[model samples]
Target: MPSRHPAEVGYGHVVESYVTRTYGGLPRCLVLNGGRFLGLRWWHTTRFTLHLLNDAAAITDEELEALLGYEWRSRLTAAWLIGVDRRERFRARIGALLLASEVCYSGSAYCFALARFGTHADAEILAAYLDHYLPRTDLHYDQPAALGALLRLDAVLGTHHSDRFTEPDGLWDQWVKGVGRLGYPSYIPTEQRRWADVQCEFANDWSRP
Candidate 1:
């Protein structure tokens, strides 16, 4: 992580100014322009730009869609960078993306975002995704990410549905067994580890009164 925030850097300042001037200070513009700015193309600078957008008080649907269209890695990173307060506004849109058959790592990113910022309805959507993907033997990385989201949701909301399909414990057990059976590959382990970390962080944050 960059010690200096995005606003502290010259390129960051320039991007912010452009967004304020050209887009009436919408945070979404900052996100879009940050990606377009030649000076901010480096990984660290881009991460800073995402931090800037994530810190925004509000982001419009149009803005988010634009962000989602960014490079796959950046799009996934943006999903995690977004603040929880703004998650609800993007939930339906993110859910739509998650359900799309074509999405890959970015879809998993949407799952992680929902775990951090979703409501009960959002949880239901994640559960549906988990139910849809968990059974396939072909091996998909997003399944673990989806399971992680469902687990986090259960931790935040308390156990609502006790059945195997919806319950966190059951889902977790299934994921573990599935992983064991399939054998851990490089990408699979990475995603599973990330999911665990995300779940822990979400649980900690939600525990705060």
Candidate 2:
């Protein structure tokens, strides 16, 4: 694996401090940080920062715009954090990024986030991603996250396409198997497991009404 970025390391420490002081619990902080623990991996820290921003109760448009300008991960997370309530200001940018073929894991993250907080059109965008984009990509670690996103989308919309890309077993279960077949262990971080559990709960609730 490549070395962690200095900024990522610093961000990890900062997030750890926040968890220790502000949240008073690592679990809460990790949830807000999108299942990232106190690690120095650049991608993990990046996701954590985006989740932190997303959980913030209030963010000025200027602050969000600055975040949107930071990097692809930041931009996608910002788009998700902004949610449907503030869709008008950032929808075009998010759409453009989603359509950009060069955007990678962040794009997948955006798809997951959008499915939860986006409009119908955004859901269509995610369906397009599932139908067209995901198959062509050579995803490794993030495949489960993307699969989880699709599962969430299916849960909400009652449309089933997760099995189309994964195994016949089930959503999360099959993704774990698929990842194992790809030579990666099916070990999700503790925080992500919690997140996945919550998604499963939410899916169940949505299926009710």
Candidate 3:
């Protein structure tokens, strides 16, 4: 293993810190150092994720699995680590978490990981998530995030899995029913904001093929 930098984070520490963490954050912001990144400052509670990307080389699958068992922020960080490493084995676990929707704010990270995998199987997982959740308009899950990831995979692989969902009167159309009204509490969740931001981060900083 490479020598651990004094400032680099460890996977074990990340898995344990979720017990008292706050402010769910995206991995893109975490590494890119933006305003909304979860672990920007190490002195504060949010720094559990700081230097996590730098520590990716030493991360183990078991460590990631442990992280998956925690709350939303840890799961989000774990998923980001998994996606960044392209650890294909965790695809099913990530899909399961996205489907379970046990908590809020982490669904987008799961979607980002699925998109990172960019395989037909990942598309299927995203499709399955859409099939199960989009119809439940009563619950606001990661519908937009899953839909966006599916569309991205379909475009890359030239498949039509998302066509049915995107068609008129489809689940997505139904889910989008409450947008634009002045007093309506819910609105159509757009994936572009989170999806595009994370995608750009991976493409630009992959250290290239």
Candidate 4:
């Protein structure tokens, strides 16, 4: 059954409908009267989609589960956005994320999000699942994004690799070494990454792209 709360149900429908209409298909753009092509910012997309995921707790378990396994990057992006931005907001819905391990990009989104919100215990949950997925791959895995997310989480939690980060010595160490191999250069700091002044150029690029 759908959620009985009108606000919750309405928000859920709004997001579900939007995803159905536009998630993975052709990008949305338009032409201005000045004859300029305009498109949406990745930040806008991430934020809007995140609004839906922020409401994840209100949706039924079934609806939440359905979203977990969605194939498109948009859906996974939504999940990761929630993981990073609204991790505390959806604390109750995390089990669904963990169960979504089989979905293509879902694991990365889920793992990173959990890392962000998970308590010491929650971190343990993520660490348990660490071995199954690798750091980087051409199509799906993004080491920079994942490690970036984890580092951000660590900062938020105010704890270092004390309890949760430990993995079997050789395997986890090898993955860390592999990540180092990628020469993952740091981008702008987190505050810089999101600010209007620093991001204005990329925002303009999105509008033009």
Candidate 5:
């Protein structure tokens, strides 16, 4: 989708400057600049950029042609690149992707990062992930990247639910154990540990707004 705001394109130039200075090279800056304006196109451009950035070795048999192709990669990278300062601009689409059942496990970290902003939509996604995906015995326990996604999900959910969710003693333990079974890191800060607990309590509510 083209940006409703014309200035958003201009702001893309500003981001180019920032990314250029931050990366200490002009080539990466240009790529990032394309990414920002690509937000105007939004889905396709972002997906292509991410595919180029993350991997170029060879296409995979498991890749989803309709949804999981280059476009999805761009959206994922857009989520990956969005800093705390620029989150509001991409929040809606990112939130939509997270709640969709079609969202890939490989893109989980992007969703987890979005949750750090703690929007209600993000909270909803975390609740859904906890309730639906985390409990299956055949859960993709061997994927370490999935664990990063879970940790970020846990971190954000923990921040929100730490107070009320902690009333029960064993609630958090079951969660930690579940994630730990997958070989994820065990130590979440007391302040940032509640998502693990709440994921244990989620009841498969995937309803999104």
Candidate 6:
């Protein structure tokens, strides 16, 4: 809300600088009792989460608009703000981002944002994402999350948009079943855990003498 904030910001800095400038107590992460860093994501820390929530509350349309569709961190933060506030104006942008799937982990956030908007349009967006990405068994993207969001929205809006995808041995079924067949994907680009991938990764880690 302050005019003192810069008109533009760069990768990683956009959300961080905005929150730090607008609110003073933002931490890069929250150190838990186990000595693991909570990391600056989602609502993990009360102080920092409050900072993000407050920042989202005060972010002007201009700031919000600037934050979306840029760096992953900024984009994720922007999606969170839009979803939390139910900013329906940015629904299309979120849907576009979901379809683009360019931001990797950003899909879940986008899906959640659409669900928050809670309209048939939102369900349509989720369905559209599934329709586009569900077939690529070779690529395990956010199909599960997107479909889950669609089902959630369907429940709320009384729409059966998810039925076609969820039918027996359909695309969704193939995806779930085929993942294990990809026993060792040459690349785990998204770092999303796949069928039996945890042990493989763990074996790699353990084998490292």
Task: Give the per-residue lDDT digits (tens) of candidate 3, residues 65-178.
Answer: 766776666677677667766788998889888888887777877887878788999989988998998777666667777877787777778998888988877777777673
Tell me, what's the RMSD of every candidate?
10.9, 9.5, 7.9, 9.9, 14.2, 11.1
lDDT of 4 by residue, 72-104 (tens): 343454454454343455554653455434444
Whole-model Cα lDDT of every candidate shown, in order: 0.53, 0.47, 0.64, 0.40, 0.38, 0.60
TM-score of each prediction: 0.56, 0.50, 0.71, 0.45, 0.38, 0.69
Q: Please identify which of the two predictions, 1 or 6, would achieve the higher lDDT against the true structure.
A: 6
Off by over 4 Å in 5: 1-75, 83-89, 99-108, 140-172, 179-209
Candidates 3 and 6: which is better by lDDT? 3
Q: How accurate is candidate 6 locally (lDDT)?
A: 0.60
- For candidate 1, report its TM-score: 0.56
Instruction: Please write out the lDDT profile of model 2 over residues 1-209, one tens digit for every residue.
Output: 13232244334332222232333333332343453333345345444444444454355555555544445445544554554234455655665556554444455445545555535555565555545544443344344444555556566667665556555453445545555677877644344434544633432232211
Model 2 misses residue 126 by how many Å? 1.9
The TM-score between candidate 2 and the true structure equals: 0.50
Can you tell me which runs of candidate 4 are displaced by over 4 Å?
Answer: 1-18, 23-61, 69-100, 116-118, 131-146, 162-173, 176-209
The candidate maximizing TM-score is 3
| Model 5 lDDT on a 0 to 1 scale | 0.38
Q: Please name the candidate that would achieve the greatest lDDT relative to the true structure.
A: 3
lDDT, candidate 2, at 79: 54
CA shift of 3, model 3, Å = 32
User: Residue 1 in candidate 4 has what lDDT?
Assistant: 24
Model 3 lDDT-worst window of ten: 1-10
